[model samples]
Target: MKLHGYFRSSASYRVRIALNLKGLSAEHLSHHLRKGEQRAADYLAINPQGFVPTVQGDGANLTQSLAIIEWLDETHPEPPLLPKEPLRRARVRAFAQVIACDTHPIQNLKILARLRELGLPEEKVTEWAAWANREGLAACEK
Candidate 1:
């Protein structure tokens, strides 16, 4: 198995954790996100989204960290990531989505880059990120 990812990508970090938990070791391939290596033609051919944490194995190419982790859980099944019960599993997934989808995006590398490009002041950007994180966490806690 091969994992194509940037070291600093949260999505990639999650996948790496899952792989470790499952006792699965994949060949690590780094794509420099800051240098736009992920947008290169060869990488884009495999992952149209140009995002990190793409796994190539079993004649399948998988993107999206959550989906990839779930696939690993399904295929490995030794140390399960999700609960066996359906409702509990749904709650777990929902909690993950709250962090991955709602919180992380607001302060992700790409979004922060765009914020800089748009001339947002550094202090303002920091404040925005903190606010987003706080709000998301508060909602998840509730």
Candidate 2:
């Protein structure tokens, strides 16, 4: 198994955590996110989106952290990550999505880079990130 990701990627972290708990290991290949290594042609061929936390194994290539985590849970089944009960499971998925989907993207490197390209001042960029993080975290906290 091979996990292609950057060390700094939160999505990558999530997969690593699950892999640890499940007593699984993969060949970890880190693409330096800040250096734009993820956009390399070789990586892009495997993952057209060029995002981190892509898993290639078992004749399958998977991307997206949440999907990978869920696949792990489904396949491994020991020490299951999500609750078996439906309501609690739904709540847990909601929380995960709040962090992975709702919050992370707005202030992610890509968006922030685009902001910089659009001539947003550094201070303004920082402020935007802070606001996004604060708002998303507040929701998660609730």
Candidate 3:
């Protein structure tokens, strides 16, 4: 088993936590996102999305950190990462989607890059990130 990820990626961090909880060790491969190494041909072959946090194991390739984490939790159920009850699990999944789908997609490097390309200053960039985070947290309270 192998995991290709960057250290600071929240998605990668979730995978790390899930792996630790599962007590399984896969070969860790770090693809530097900042240096744009994730866009390189070799890594793109592994993940067409050209993103970090790609897991290859059991002759299968998996991308999207949440999917990988859920796969781990589903397959290795020793310390369940999610609640057991179906309804409760649904709520938990909604919460996870708040981060994975809503918050993360906005604050990701690609979005930031687009913001920068639009001539937005650093302060505005920070403000955008903070606002997105705040909104996500506010949604959680609802």
Candidate 4:
């Protein structure tokens, strides 16, 4: 198995933790997101979304950290990550999506870069990220 991701990416970090928890090992391949290495043709072929944390294994390439983690959990069920109960499982997934889809996307490197490109001041960009994180986490806590 191989993991293509950037070091500082939270999405990649989540996958790393999942892999560790599942006792699964994969070759680490770093794509410098700041340098825009993810946009390269080779990587694009592997993951059209050009996002980090793409797992190449089992003759399939998987994108999206949540999907990859769920696949890992399903394939290796010794240490289950999701609850068996339907309602509890839905709640857990919703909580995870709050963090992954809501908080992380707003603070992601690409979004921050775009904010800078759009002439937003550094302070404002930082404030946006902070605010997004605060609100998303607060909602999750509730």
Candidates ranked, most accurate by lDDT first: 2, 4, 1, 3
TM-scores of all predicted structures: 0.89, 0.96, 0.92, 0.93
Flag regions of model 2 displaced more than 4 Å.
none
lDDT of 2 by residue, 27-77 (tens): 999999999998999999988887898999999999999999999999999
Candidate 2 matches the true fold with a TM-score of 0.96
| Candidate 4 positional error at 107, Å | 2.3
lDDT of each: 0.92, 0.93, 0.92, 0.93
Candidate 1 wrongly placed segments (more than 4 Å): 140-142
lDDT of 3 at 12: 89
User: Which of candidates 2 and 4 is the stronger one according to TM-score?
Assistant: 2
Order candidates by TM-score, high to low. Answer: 2, 4, 3, 1
Task: Using lDDT as the measure, name the better of candidate 1 and candidate 2.
Answer: 2
User: How would you encode candidate 1's per-residue C-alpha lDDT over 33-115 as one tens digit per residue?
Assistant: 98999889999999998889899999999999999998999999998888989999999999999999999988977788789
Kindly state the number of residue pairs that clash in model 3.
0
Scored by lDDT, model 4 comes in at: 0.93
Tens digit per residue, CA lDDT, model 4, 31-124: 9998999989999999998889899999979999999999999899979998899999999999999999888988888799999999999999
